[model samples]
Target: LWGEACATLETSVGPNNFNHWIKPLRLTGLESGIAHFVSPTRFISDWVNRHFAKDIIGVLSRPGQPVERLRFDVVPQAAPGRARSAASGSAASVRPVASAAAPATTRALRADLGAPLDPRYTFGNFVVGKPNELAHAAARRVAEGGPVGFNPLFLYGGVGLGKTHLMHAIAHDYQMRHPAAQVLYLSAEQFMYRFVQALRESTIMDFKGMFRNVNMLMVDDVQFIAGKDSTQEEFFHTFNALVDQGKQIVISADRAPAEIKGLEERIKSRLSCGLIVDLHPTTYELRLGILQSKTEGFRAQQPDLQIGTGVLEFLAHRITTNVRVLEGALQRLFAHASLLRREITLEVAQECLADILRTNDRKISIDDIQRKVAEHYNIRLADMVGPKRARNIARPRQIAMYLSKQLTSRSLPEIGRRFGGRDHTTIMHGIRKIEELLSEDKAIAEDVAMLKRLLEA
Candidate 1:
């Protein structure tokens, strides 16, 4: 019965933790529904009682015949082969028991759960820009904490916008300052997988205890937990427990909580309780800053690689969407130049990144124009395509149709077909309307210029 309880606890608390805490105890006997066990030292016995007693009791309790109590004793023997490190306390004492008794399956699962963080994602390396300054400030304040000013600091943004970078920086910062504070950083998929594993093994209490005891919890890409009700419910409780106790909780996702489809309203409201910062697409200046910083870092590694002055400006202006891609382009350029014994000039870069550069330079399609215009005007894609008499979708859709005609080689009917199967006459009318706007409104001309630059780049 004691062995079975330990197995159940192992499944719930995770193999690494189970091996550390429960593997060393000797099951002396069971009597009157009471289980008695002995540890190697008094410290181990007390630590076990403090952290795992309630969970142990819950695991041992069954439908009808359940263990009512647990007893622990300290016994000194030629220390068990599995002994906790003296510094790690009694938990480390159980190391041998895990080595001998732990299954290969358990070891593999533990390895899967022990995902190492990327070392490059430190606070020192993160570049702060106007778009992410508020998020950065909020994260800094949370890291230097007394009372929890924000229950759950939610950061959302498009891909490659440094959402994950900021979250890692926060975790690394807190861990360095407060070494004793328990920090658990995992993706929402990881959380859900662990929860489901615990459920299958009937060790929900163990699962609850693992997350509940943490002083800081950071979950990345939380939108993955949107439709899974059981996982979401468990996460909600874990979130509240940590927040109610004034512990720091941080989450990152691609969109705002409310905008995340299928998320529970209560969970969304809880997420919105504190600061919710959105990381916008990097501006040209911000991209240049990132490129300059990245180039300097690269230069330290390869002092001989000569990246010309206007190279960064050209790259920054061209690769405008994400910082990651920009860095990748630079890396590719450096590698190609170094291997081929060539100068890292604009011509070499253009050759090395020909595929990416070509895709970047390709003229905007009619489809892309419609999508971008609809997004800018805050109108639905369907409404833009539909015969809606409302000016909201109609005007923007017309502007998109005009841009497509002026920008691409598509004929009138072809352009119309791309915009909800309208006739060539409709396309002509839309183009005329936008042309009139361009002549009268400076704002419209500026918008056209910006869109053209974005599309061309």
Candidate 2:
């Protein structure tokens, strides 16, 4: 009866988990409504008891072989080579009179050992727009932990554009659905730091054992691993091992994989091998939507304060850099208003965010951008500003027009006159064309992001 129960337990955990974890636990006894087991070491005993004891207990407490509870202890003289012979003795182990009817539930997430998850970054708080809708959807899919369409969901974009937020949101949602999930989330820098620490301590095997065994792995700002040869090498192997086991991986970066300088070619290849989604720069409406969402949360906190309309619109229009900065500005304004006991209005927005608005001032010119775009697309400078409707010239022209509207303070009419004396509606149409491409066309979006970075720098 015990042998049949052990076989059932083995099938429940799969071969890999059974061999590594179950093969070591020796059933010592079944007495006084307690089923006692011993492992070779405290680490193995604790790990098994934490991760697999519930299933093992369930099998042991079957109708034939019953046990009220499971207990694990370390065997000081137990040897790994002898576990095969000794663990079989567990088959002859005795049974208890009364058994615990309920089995232990799955253990909680191992989030404490890695980076901590911020409860506020869940999907409910994320504001979606055309720019970030794809990213948001992909993240939600990965969180579902079903048939993952993408192996490593790579999310890259400008700073404070919700890469990390989406990553955290995935972790939170996944763990919520899977209580026993071994979900690990941390920065690339922390991974490197631990990799180095493991090397110095000669516990590299243990480090690899823990990391490579997780169900889900998320590394934020993976671009940070660029240029560090040893860290990159170790991370590559770790990433491959997890993916080979069909584990889900989520990564975030400030730029797309190919654009990150100093990163290894093979790593880039592997990173891009999976689904790559970019959280395009926030649209004005998206920014306003985010402000409104955040303001509602703040209003709930400070019920007495009545916020005016133009304040959020003003901040959303002015602070165009990143979502982090935008949220921070609103939070700061709310704090100031609460402290002063005043209503949130345009004057308050101006006085409170004066410094941030200055920094958000336009940094690029339409002409400079046209020149840069011309050089990038291998066309003459005059082609950008001249009357040329050819695909080769027009595509780059529209890209430049899009960048102009995004990065410069030029009006549509002003931008049109610069583009071969075209009308404002032509410029608007061109801008709209690029906006359409930004979602459907990857090559064009990549080019625009690269050019924008270069011009900003």
Candidate 3:
């Protein structure tokens, strides 16, 4: 009767779901007018009790074999060949694979999740700044594998904003703690490729079984599967099955799920159901810190080379677009200086990164900023530099001044001359006022940030 009921349950939830979530469950036999089941861990037991308890009860109750209800318990004796890891309090290791090639079985699974780990992208190496602190914190929580941590951890941002890096860090750290746990980390493109391969070879059951049974599943650049309907459908079901089983899932994308066009509404809601964190573009201070950390590593290798003062500062100030670009510029600077035996001066930086500087060069002028700010605030362009001390016009003028100071390399006196012949001190004061308001006022900060992105874009 028990075997009959399990077969019925497997049909209801599909093959992959049953293999991953239901198969691990052990029926300890019916007792006290109620059926008792055993699970490997507390998470699995609780999940089954909440989601499938009633259905399982209905299935087990037969004409002769009457059962009142169902109950689940965590008993280590029921699970075999599993041992807990010291790194993670609740995690246990799985069976070891003999080789890297576990194709359609556990062989390919070893190679797929094993070699992609980047030792450099750990929590220790990741620098936390205002732009990325929230994303970092959320990633850390998910990595901890706490029961209360939100599922379907969604991280999205523009290029080089550390979205992929954070995702990789989570995988690396989680694997370290849960050495026995199955952590499948890959890009969405790879996911689609493997899915198609399974379909072509009629081995989808193997694919589904392997993917569905993992402890942690991470898909990077999930936006790639947006317009691909078949892949999205498969991923949607896989996602629902995992979430229903109380497993931890992590995803990364270039943009928010809702902003991604051609994606299913159901998938969007599922992705958004959990915590969503966005990493803002790198700031000046963050850029400097990153350069500092990178240069410290370089200094150990080349002790004879000298880095001139203001070199890193200039690079940080000039290269404001992406961290990847910034790191590349630093590498180029060090290589150029070492090969030529020249100090890493601002001139050397300029010469080595001339192409990048030209590409990311800010083209917005004082007038351009004034026009944009006026247009954004619905104010008169003439009033931007006009002698109107009214709050409405004066605030817009100050925002323009602040933008000119930030988005351009113009000096205070030069920017002041553009604004009705005001002194440089007045320009500095206005810039300071906006800077203070940036911390105090959320609306102003968002407006300024949005305007900057538009102008910069």
User: How high is each candidate's TM-score?
Assistant: 0.61, 0.61, 0.68
Deviating ranges (above 4 Å) for candidate 3: 1-104, 113-115, 362-368, 375-378, 385-402, 409-457
> For residues 248-306, could you state the per-residue lDDT of candidate 1 as single tens digits?
99999999999999899999999999989998777767888888888788879878878
State, as a TM-score between 0 and 1, how close model 1 is to the true structure.
Answer: 0.61
Give all candidates' CA lDDT scores: 0.74, 0.78, 0.78
Local error of candidate 2 at 403, Å?
11
> How does candidate 2 fare on TM-score?
0.61
Alpha-carbon RMSD to native, per candidate: 14.4, 13.2, 16.4
Candidate 2 segments exceeding 4 Å error: 1-112, 362-457
Give per-candidate clash totals.
5, 1, 6
Candidate 3, position 49, lDDT:
64
Task: State which candidate has the highest TM-score.
Answer: 3
Candidate 2: what lDDT? 0.78
Residue-level lDDT of model 2, residues 1-457, one tens digit each, is: 4566668877898877787667656676767667776544434455576678778778777575567777654332322244454235444543231221211110111222367667678899999998899999999999999985688999999888999889989987876566445677899999998889879978687678768867799999999999999999999999999999999999999888999898899889998888999988887788999999998898888888767778887777667778998988998988998999988889888888878766776556788899999999899999988887899999999999998887766789989888878999999999999999999999988888778767754
